[model samples]
Target: MTSIASTSQAPPLVLTVAGSDSGGGAGIQADLKTMLALGVHGMSVVAAVTAQNSLGVQGYWELPPEAVRAQLDSVLSDIGVHAIKTGMLASTVLVETVAEALAGCDAPVVVDPVGVSKHGDALLAPEAVDAVRSALLPVATVVTPNLFEVEQLTGVKVVDETGMREAAEAVLALGPRWALIKGGHLPGEPADLLSDGEREYRFTAPRHDNRHTHGTGCTLASAIASHLAMGDDVPAAAEKAKEYVTGAIAAGFPLGAGIGPVDHGWRQRA
Candidate 1:
């Protein structure tokens, strides 16, 4: 152990710009947990604060645009993240502010268009949808949207695997380098569709019956960011993230008499 510090390497830095979940299930908490489990240094810019638990989101208050911008500038200017993941932007102003901050960064950006929680509680405002489409998504390296969020952002309702491509196309038209349409909400198998404007890829995993998937979206997006920070391309990153989330979903466990979070440290537990 004489000079082990000289041989040690620092982990890649990944940043999450999201809301805070008081119950430690979703948002910034889940993002950091996923990043940690995936071997990355995680940083956070909390855009909003939520009074939430396993049941549902009670109320959330968005940080002022200036405060959000200050936090973003502090991290991005000094630490210089390798990748950025976004979630739960509660208002149009915060979304716009975050979009501007991300536009200046050279790192890969993972945008999780979080529209609702696992319990069907709304996380994003209706007015912020356009801001996300016009400002946030355009700057994204990969946009991850669940079925309902896909419909919310792109107006493409994916009822089956056949509709996933359409949904990906709609999101691609918004200008992200890639779009990942998450099919976890669809019945039967859990599938995710990823696409650039020209090529398409589909990842399917056996559906798990566990209901404690409260943080899947946040976890998946953070995992993608972590992979990207570790030098994987967008398609490769999404594929790996899909694999990790599938395992986490299978390992989900109940908490507080309601839905619980996916186990971010499932690999260690296994």
Candidate 2:
């Protein structure tokens, strides 16, 4: 018999505390896919479950606070994590639960304040918005919010590229170390602003004509966390993540009856 050889090296580990998307376009599914594509080991703590598809989210149900806490403890206690990412925490209890668990964590955290689905379906509860602001945002190393989420969290409505700086400031005031304000919704080229109160970095990409960008938010946040786990600074991670997401968006292909997902494996294809 031939002897098998094995290596001792292991990839960085990234944990995603979020919801599960049945359609496999966003939430935990997208997070894990992004992690894998970026060469990280992906772990998950499902905070909610959604009946979602290309068209819209029909409904969602959050897990009990105790269950969510248990998952977090189980993952953090034994396997450990190099970084963490969060998305679509559906309720106030779950938001508070996850925040409490991550309060003293040493690893970097990426928070995607997901307010609505791609089809305009509500993902985060309106009442839970306060919990996300008071509890969740404070624990984030970096918070990535789209225009709608920026307004939902800070009442800062960003209508153009110029307003992104103000939006980043408003999110930073909520206690995150850095804020990444996504300006994809604005007309013209898609631009995103990253700031840490003092220095600022703007990332812009020519708008792809594709509309199948269902998992862009989750994918970008997860990619940032994966890069952070691999020892990149916040700004460098954001830059690389933006590049990866832009390629994925450009390679997006339609699925189901409506919007589709960005190709998580685009790098591999290229």
Candidate 3:
């Protein structure tokens, strides 16, 4: 009998399609860091580039649609991402390209409908909002949006905790099987409302009294993707991700003259 060689397998791959933050506070940097911290292999596709920092974004330029599509194919064809997370697709073409590519990929997708940076800079174009709704969101396994994003997508104002239901309902209507409306932007305790159209779950956390919460959204979405790659269910992944982001916020640090990014490595340091 001839002996055969054993092949070593690679870890599960998670891909993030987003912008580049020069400051490394949010966007691609935050996504990769969060994925790594959660013990998942992370990949990237640059959709846009921005001169950004703690203060704000100075300028931005989106990549050509063909380039974006090519990058997606290059990765999905070879490395085979286990989960996909998207953020800051600045134009309608890029959004459409991602949607078309991911529509057939069999994997959980965590969609962070990022409309703005942490410092209130406009990252998404008005024309692209429609694309995000019609193209990307429908294919999302879990759509994670904060108060502003909820309003942008659904035309609903999230004034308080009670409004999370309406926001989630509207988000589910956009075709995502699950919607996680982050309530951290709401007053009172830090909590999030998740709905699968049939069921709803509340993830509560003690609000950290820290201003260093720049990358919380990106971190949460990446964490959820990581857990999904590790085989956690939607509800479990969302809950665990919320807990992780809370801890990260609690341990957040100020890096520049303005609000800073959350500490993605808080758990390791502890």
Clashes of each: 0, 0, 0
Q: Rate the local accuracy (lDDT) of all candidates.
A: 0.92, 0.95, 0.92
Local accuracy of candidate 1 as per-residue lDDT tens digits, 1-270:
475447777799999999999988899999999999999999999999999988888899989999999999999888899999999999999999999989989999999999888888888889999999999999999999989988997778888888998898999999999998888778888888899978888899998888889999999999999999999988888889989999998998888978998988899999
RMSD of 3: 3.3
Once fitted onto the true fold, the runs of candidate 2 whose alpha carbons sit more than 4 angstroms away are 1-5
The C-alpha stretches of model 1 lying farther than 4 A from their native spots are 1-7
- Give, for candidate 1, the lowest lDDT window spanning 10 residues: 1-10
Per residue, candidate 2 scores C-alpha lDDT tens digits across 94-180 of 999999999979999999999999899999889999999999999999999999999999999988899999999999999999999
* Order of quality (TM-score): 2, 1, 3
Pairing residues by index, what is the TM-score of model 1?
0.96
By the TM-score metric, which is better: model 1 or model 2?
2
Clashes of 2: 0
Q: Which one wins on TM-score?
A: 2
